[model samples]
Target: MVRLFILLAAVQLVLFVLALISCLSAARVRNAPRLVWVLVILLIPLLGPLAYFLWGRPLPAPEEGTVPRRRRAPSAPDDDPDFLRSVDTEQSRREREALAQWEKELENGEPDKPQGSA
Candidate 1:
């Protein structure tokens, strides 16, 4: 008889703690305010927690009139035509000039050392 009483007390404590935690942490609980739900849980013990779990949980509502967006990987800079076209015109001219200088040096017997590298 004593063992049975201790088991029931443990069950009641578990129910009360679980109910309080669930009530406090829920995104939005049911009709009653959070303060009221908390009071209900504390005052009523086992029944308070059970009632909150059954009726106070938020139900996910589908958003109306919205089209689902398709998830796609972002395009790389090389894959984007707009990004490729956006390269600086001055930079392109500089690259062309450098290439011409390198080719001219290769043809000449005496060549100048490259400027950027020591």
Candidate 2:
């Protein structure tokens, strides 16, 4: 009976050590508070491990060969007003330059000059 008790105690001790180590390791990987993890492992020894197993593992990244589905890029109208304004200003500048060149050519009557009549 004493031998059986000793064996059971040894098994419990090993499990507790494993749980503590795993909790510490997982907490380190997860960037969680070490003191909180230590307390959890010590206080709710069995449930702590179960909780970590269910929630601690990082979600898998998308596979290397898989093509991500096409999605529209998010526009930050309010958050990035300056960026939108810059784009708008650039487009306006191009339009103005094009119009100016066209008006200058028209004023010079270049298009009205007979084409292919050298």
Candidate 3:
């Protein structure tokens, strides 16, 4: 019976320390504030630590659940509106002309050969 009591006490002490460290280190917590959580862990024995574990722990940051920015956003120049907007109009017109010429070459079924070199 003495051994059992000693084991329980040890468990309670471990719980109290874990709860206190978690409460202090967390960037934010839910329900009660940090001081209240600290007090609860220190004063309420086993139940205090259990309550802090259940209610005072912070929710996962919202960004953690979603795809990262690189995966979620467009990676290609032609597909991204912002990239197109930042391009100079003259440069954009030149690109369009180059694309049109390439398409015309494809339609003609001619083997692509370097011009001005042949």
Candidate 4:
């Protein structure tokens, strides 16, 4: 019974150390919320470290080429009627062009470039 108690205490101490280390390491990374990290360390103990292992690492920033700019929200509807009308006109023109091209392709059939065609 005494041996079992000592083993349990040692295991708990190791778990606590692992959790603390993971939490502190995560805190060093920029942009991590400190308060949320502290709560994670205290509330979940063993699982907290594992959770952080899986989710705590920072996500890579969008790469240089082809990454869309992050937008907070869409621009509000334009107040000027003419400006809005111009935007709508531009969009409709593009849509009509796309439809015309698709209709032409449908009439002509697809290009015969698919692989494995004898």
Best by lDDT: 3
What TM-score against the true fold does each predicted structure earn?
Answer: 0.48, 0.34, 0.52, 0.33
**For model 2, how big is the CA root-mean-square deviation?**
12.3
Over 1-118, each residue of candidate 3 has an lDDT whose tens digit, in order, gives 9999999999999999999999999998889888999998899999999999999998766576686454456777888887777786768899999999999989999768987875
Residue pairs with colliding backbones in model 4 are: none
* Cα lDDT tens digits for candidate 2, 48-107: 655544554334567899976566555766557677889899999999999998899999
Candidate 1 per-residue lDDT, tens place, 1-118, comes to: 9999999999999988888888888888887998889998899878888887787756656579875556554478877665666675667988999999888888895478767976
Please give the CA lDDT of all the candidate structures: 0.81, 0.68, 0.88, 0.69
Q: Which number leads on TM-score?
A: 3
Ranking of candidates on TM-score, top first: 3, 1, 2, 4
Which ranges of candidate 1 are over 4 A from the true structure?
Answer: 60-118
lDDT of 1 at 77: 80
After superposition, candidate 3 runs with Cα above 4 Å error? 62-118
**Which tens-of-lDDT digit does each residue in 95-114 have in candidate 4?**
99999988887889975455
Alpha carbon lDDT of residue 44, candidate 1?
Answer: 87
Name the lDDT of candidate 1.
0.81
Q: How close is candidate 1 to the true structure, as a TM-score?
A: 0.48
On lDDT, the stronger of 1 and 2 is 1
